[model samples]
Target: MGAAFRARTPSLAQLFDEDMLGDDLEAWLNESFLLKRTFRTCAVIAGLIDQRHPGKEKTGRQVTVSADLIYDVLRMHEPDHILLEATRHDAATGLLDIGRLGSMLKRIKGHITHRRLDRISPLAVPVMLEIGRESVHGEAHDFLLTEAADELIIEAMGIGHTAGE
Candidate 1:
């Protein structure tokens, strides 16, 4: 028998370790949210995590779904991100119940049209929203795209009304 060697398998926490991301991840998240209130909420939550953990690992399986990061980056004060993440995770795992996501997608489609931004061509929005929704269901991937979608609609509406004025 040749020398025995075991393939190293990184733990779930290892994959999303905070050391690998540093402040950049925080910065990116902040910029992604952009709105002063949203940014502040995210920042406060992140700071709380840092304070509570002190020297412990700040990423991994916990952070991926169960930690404050989820609230900071996705859930926070809304359920849209939670729903979207759940949908995405289900899709990635091949365990997605198409009928369920189809219904959610239908809801998303209604929102998109309501924003009047459908004219801008929203090909990827549905897919991303589905995935984002899946993430909240403890499926793979981090961060849902729901917040971005809302921001896009808010911005689009702002522009639409301004143009009319």
Candidate 2:
């Protein structure tokens, strides 16, 4: 018989050790919503394992969805790097859901059209025209977009607006 070899699996805490800021990482993972918590936790743990054991190849379980499909979804939902960065920072502080707001705004902006609305209601034409005009002015458009995003976030979260006030 050939020489016997033992295969050992490391515990999660061992894979993501304390020396590598495991406590802070765990806290961050725990703070995420239920929908994202498992995937984020696995990603963090896999990343840590890869960092610690660069020589060993780490393979994940087969996923039903293809990588291309996942990339397409990300491309659709996460269009702006600035918005993504803001969302990541806000996650730690529990400030706001900027990602969702940005996604909603993107979809709404895409659907805004004079021809489409003209068929539905002629009275709404002036409002669409005003929106089109505001969108052309850089600074005004940015301010309006931010306000709309904030309002969308607040309404979705069912939170009070103007918390300090």
Candidate achieving the largest lDDT: 1
Q: Write the per-residue lDDT of candidate 1 for residues 41-120, one digit (tens) a residue.
A: 44445553233356776555543333344444564566465343443443334433445544655554424321234353
Model 2: number of clashes?
0
Q: Provide the TM-score for each candidate, comma-separated.
A: 0.17, 0.17
TM-score of 2: 0.17
Question: What's the lDDT for residue 82 in model 2?
Answer: 40
Give lDDT: candidate 1, residue 142.
27
**Number of clashes recorded per candidate:** 21, 0
